[model samples]
Target: MNTLSILPFFRRLAGTCRLASALLAGALTLPAAADALPLEKIALPPGFTIELLARVPNARQMALSPQGVLYVGSMRAGKVHALPLDRDYRPGKLRVVADDLKLPVGVAWRDGSLYVSAVDRILRLDGIDARLDDPPAPAVVRDDLPKETHHGWKFIAFGPDGWLYVPVGAPCNICEPDPERYATILRMRPDGSQLQTFARGVRNTVGFDWHPASGALWFTDNGRDWLGDDRPPDELNHAPKPGLHFGYPYCHGDAIADPEFGRKRACDEFTPPAQNLGPHVAALGMRFYTGSQFPAQYRNQVFIAEHGSWNRGRKIGYRVSVVTLAGDRAVSYAPFASGWLQDESAWGRPADVLVLPDGSLLVSDDQAGAIYRIRYAGERKASGIPQ
Candidate 1:
């Protein structure tokens, strides 16, 4: 469909449903536009400011093209959007790139094509950035992925090795399924050839990135639930090379044995997490800071979006977190931006984060159906840190 046709459809959808705001309690006001929300409610560290980049319904993952067009995907909304940005990297016109897709939660840009993952299939829109106003029909890249809806949505990215990496989660909360099909990260050439499993024994990984200097893979794995609030913490795992298996059905954080499957295998047989995050933090989309916008200390640090916990009695996450690394080891993990969850109520949930070329960061909140831009505006002292 053309931009004109899809623009009206979104306006109608936005006017009647208010998809994101409806999830909140009755007390919260329904912001017609993202700007209507009280921005001060979101708390950030000193010298940083956040603003609404765009109001994208069910915005789950984002990809930016070389020509400055941002493509966003949706999970439940079954749609993909493209927003052309101006010279300031601010969004200009919004257009629907594709719709009627199934759980299209991941998007990636490479070599003038925009790749979208819809559960079982990967579709590509060719020359998408140059034709946002009138996008062409999507061509299939791959369609043989597992179709299980349980934890089936994927996050895809091109690694430093020039291969496309995709993860497949276990179909159940915790079970040993077909090793070749589930609980693994797979990589393939751009044309969807030479598919091979990269990492195994992963429960569910929604985000991953290669280290800036080392080029090793790091990912966030959501821990299996129903183990109480503090039992199995989510994980930040490192896979320096292929054939690494992260403990999943058998073991959890720091070699904690699983109640059912732990007896089958020893915890020490598999790789352990580099850093154990909060229990059920649902950490997603992470990126290594390669821009000079922040302090020098943050140059190679990793920033994560914690989607927050739902089953835990006391909620955690719903914030942007940072993991400081010291030569491949995580030295510290802390909150960078929070305030989404207050007094057991949350109005937004962060799903993904992206670092722009200009050093600003973009965060996508699926619950709020909006994208937020975070920029470092503080002055740095002689110590090379923010004052």
Candidate 2:
């Protein structure tokens, strides 16, 4: 059946309950004509092109398998979607890898296993790609995670060190959370062993990536809201080593003291952000451009998805930005993708960005429930360069 025909059945089969009710509410908040949406609505640079990769409800935090299958984890839908791709990068087919999950938001594949993070627990499915149609029963890798529904959904990634990194966001807009709760980055073994706090005071960093050259962990932190339109800016931070602190609650932006959490402590206690990504720009997933297809200037720069803002009177973000670095310092910033928010009154939210093997970038827009592929066609080279 066509995707449109299958959506209604899926919606009914999803059952009528509180979670389903919430999903319905969220769906209603979306644009009325979701199918008519085009990539042009999401602005990008001149030479770059955007195409819808797939349509999956509430898709976020993507992970790709070795064979190039895109695995998407959902927040409101409580399922993981496996999207099949042809050799040319066209989305060929799609299937539900796992369902009935409790607001699963993070997904990762490692060592022949798939890891999923829900609000209160972490689950593992061994040999996932081999059993995409009928995934095996999951094993609880870890439980007792924070149960707070708001801002508790995770974005998990397996670092180069073979440890799983997870973000625990502050449950509220701006508050001094419990010690075990928000504003921290946690790392643990694949089996949920050796849990440790890698960084502290990081407020709602939904996306992060390890620098390919320096191995330092760089993350994008969303600033606290309700503080007006442009006081405290969102941050792009670089943690050169573990145990570092990226200020939050107590301090924000460069050295602006928090209106609520500010105390006698010195702002110098924490490492300031490498760059200030404009105020209220709900920055999410980040990835270093390591692919060779883009211009040489694009290499190693950080691409961040700014999910945009709501609480502010004048909205910002809603587009992706590139953060350039020079020897561990943010040298410059520029917009890589735009138009997601349209006229500041309208809406489209980009949640994540992933670099494929072919040097193309795949961006996920959760508000529209679509994934867009972006590729750079060199202006210097013509369309038909004779071999």
Candidate 3:
């Protein structure tokens, strides 16, 4: 065949190969439109690129240890996972460290042990890094949490003050639950002693992290459902001290009072959100950008995984977003990566975000059962502020 005739043949072959690759990547989970390296559909800022790192079923919260093991927690899968990273920061084979537990969606590593949060208790795997192939049976650290399954899954982490922070979500959608217990963020030592309420009036907080510079705690709070599509906004909250209430059950967002419970107290009775997010966006798993791989402008900013809205008529979120902070206030909140939802059909749901030591970002998608790495591959500069 002449050169012109063969050109069309090569193009057809290339397209066929691409389609097959996408199907094989997510055949078990996502639709064919969002598989393999369909990352092309994903949008990021200039100089940034995203690639697949690993696949972990039901990946929720993520914690990276000093030795390069990335521990992930799950809810529906009821398991805890460990993914080792090579020196170049690529993910190795995944290992399920623990399985068949109740909503084990929180994992934190301290010293040499891996701490996991089940529905009603906290468990620990001693020396978990040294026993990936044959992890020891989890030992119960504390087992006195509430037994209610509604909003029971947790996202846990170690604070700067050496306390393991765990959130106990309200058992119901909206109610006058005891502030001392339900709708509270609790903190305890590694041995699960001296447990006390860190913050109150949190309906359901699935993610939190201390500020890199000031050590102030910040978190994402999901708004109550049935409040209509645009009534109450999901919150990015700032809790620098204990006993601050973020206005759950009685108030929401900056000053939107709860209709059923707001009569008991004014909206000013509690602390307001640092930034008001989209209504019913289901924001979860946030981290501060403290690495050097990205530009200096990204330092100390917040990275959030919006798992997307299931209740809204027009779907929103389903992407990783960045919140720029000036001092203690959020100056801007914008999308860092998006396009998981296309034509009202979502193929991937971003569950959590983690910053690697090399400064690349890791995003976990429970719906797609995959983890993706976002890296800066172009010339780096620190001149412009994020608009």
lDDT of 2 by residue, 1-387 (tens): 588989987787776665678767765343435354545565566677666666777878899888878889988889988887768877766788788988888999898888999978999988888787787888899997888877788899998899999888888888888745578999999999989889988888889999998888899888888778886888999888998877777888879888777784568887898999888888898999999878788899999988888787878888889998887888999888887766665456889999998999988888878787778874311111101
Clash list (residue pairs), candidate 1: none
The weakest ten consecutive residues by lDDT in model 3 span: 378-387
Q: Alpha carbon lDDT of residue 54, candidate 2? A: 68
Q: After superposition, how far is residue 348 of candidate 1 from its true place, in Å?
A: 0.3
Regions of model 2 farther than 4 Å from truth: 1-34, 378-387
| lDDT of every predicted structure (CA atoms) | 0.89, 0.83, 0.89
Model 3 misses residue 357 by how many Å? 0.5
Candidate 2 residue 140 C-alpha distance from true site, Å? 1.0
**Per-prediction backbone clash count:** 0, 1, 0
TM-score result, candidate 2: 0.87
Tens digits of per-residue lDDT for model 3, 129-183: 9899999999999999998999999899999999999999999989999889899
In lDDT terms, how accurate is model 1? 0.89
RMSD of each: 8.5, 8.0, 7.8
lDDT of 1 by residue, 1-387 (tens): 588879988898896676555656444544554235455677787788887788788988889888888889989999999988878986787799999999999999889999999889999999887787888999999999999989999999999999999999999998999988999999999999999999999999999999989999999999999999997999999999999989889999998999999999999999999999999999999999899998788889999999999999999999999999999999999999897898999989999999999999999999988888888887311111111
Query: Looking at model 1, which ten-residue stretch has the lowest summed lDDT?
Result: 378-387
Clashes of 1: 0
